[model samples]
Target: MTLRHHFTRLICAFAVSACLSQVPAFAARQPGPEQDAAQQLALQAQRAQMLSRYQAERAACMHRFFVNACLDASHKQERSALAPIDVDLQAIALRARMRAAEAEMRQVQANIAAAQTGQHDSAQAERQSAARATALAQREEQAAARARQAAAGASKVAAPPPVRPETAPPAPRLFPAPAPQPAPQPALNPAQRAAQAAQAQADYAA
Candidate 1:
């Protein structure tokens, strides 16, 4: 009977413990706006510090004999330490993106609703789209004009200058002017020379 009573007490204790476990020990804390802002600031500061530390460690590793190994080890350590921070940051960014997407969807739906109610007109939307297209075309045209002008300028700068023929000094004679031929030798006597001269004069006359 005592053993049975002891078992009954143990069962009762277990049931009570189970019930308590089903209830939260304390109310779950919901972050308020102020807390969220503070947390964001803290995270930003932490991110900056972490990046700074990583940079310092990387710089120090560069001085090591086995720089690649040192840097790899530092990167592993940094990654391990920053994993949680990165996850939190990614979660925050994803939540913001989701909120933005939801807002955009709501806006689109509202516009559709307004259009269904005749508050918006298709023609007006078409006109706006046309205006945006016209603006884009004008911008593109202006960009193309600027590009053409730049190309022209670059072409002008890159083109080689016209070649002007430089006057060259007269070429040296290949063969020296024949030395002035010596006066014909007086191979014959003065009388023969006079006779030859007379014969030349007679030929010229003829």
Candidate 2:
């Protein structure tokens, strides 16, 4: 009789607990319009942040391009202007233009070098990532191939393992430090002063 009563109590308790769980589900319910509006605002804020980041990156790239173009055009204009002068002064003009062009070209070359370095680093990283992905894919494919072979032997098929994409590491910096400048010296001695004075007089006479 006691055993029968205990089983009946256990069964009743379980039924009541199950009924209670369902009531919470019915009562809790999804969020209404105000909650939905709040969620939408949050999503918009997130999207705005993403757009800002995109815009900043775009602006930096555009600025670098514009600087390069301006430098090249300016140098071209200078070169074409210097081509029609006479012989001795023509050499002078040519030298001057060449010097200007050399300076400008060096600036452009530095810019180009920096850009090429960036591109090369980006390409190298991409290549490394590609190689890693290829290796992973090949490993997965080999694994799948082996699995398929095993399955064929055993009369059952197995799914291939998934390959995950990898992010490349940051490129190494190529910036060289500025060369150290010599420290300033103290004033010259009396003998050094006399020698400098005599040299200055000679230079003045010449």
- Colliding pairs, model 2: none
lDDT of 2 by residue, 73-151 (tens): 5545434433222222333333344344445545555665677799999999999999999999999999999998887
Candidate 1 per-residue lDDT over residues 90-129, each given as its tens digit: 5444444444444555555555566566635777788899
| TM-score attained by model 1 | 0.37
Error of 1 at 203 (Å): 99
Which stretches in model 2 have alpha-carbon errors above 4 Å? Answer: 1-109, 156-206
Q: Evaluate model 1: give its lDDT.
A: 0.70
Quote each prediction's TM-score.
0.37, 0.22
Worst 10 residues of 2 by lDDT: 82-91
Model 1: runs farther than 4 Å from truth? 1-38, 63-65, 119-206
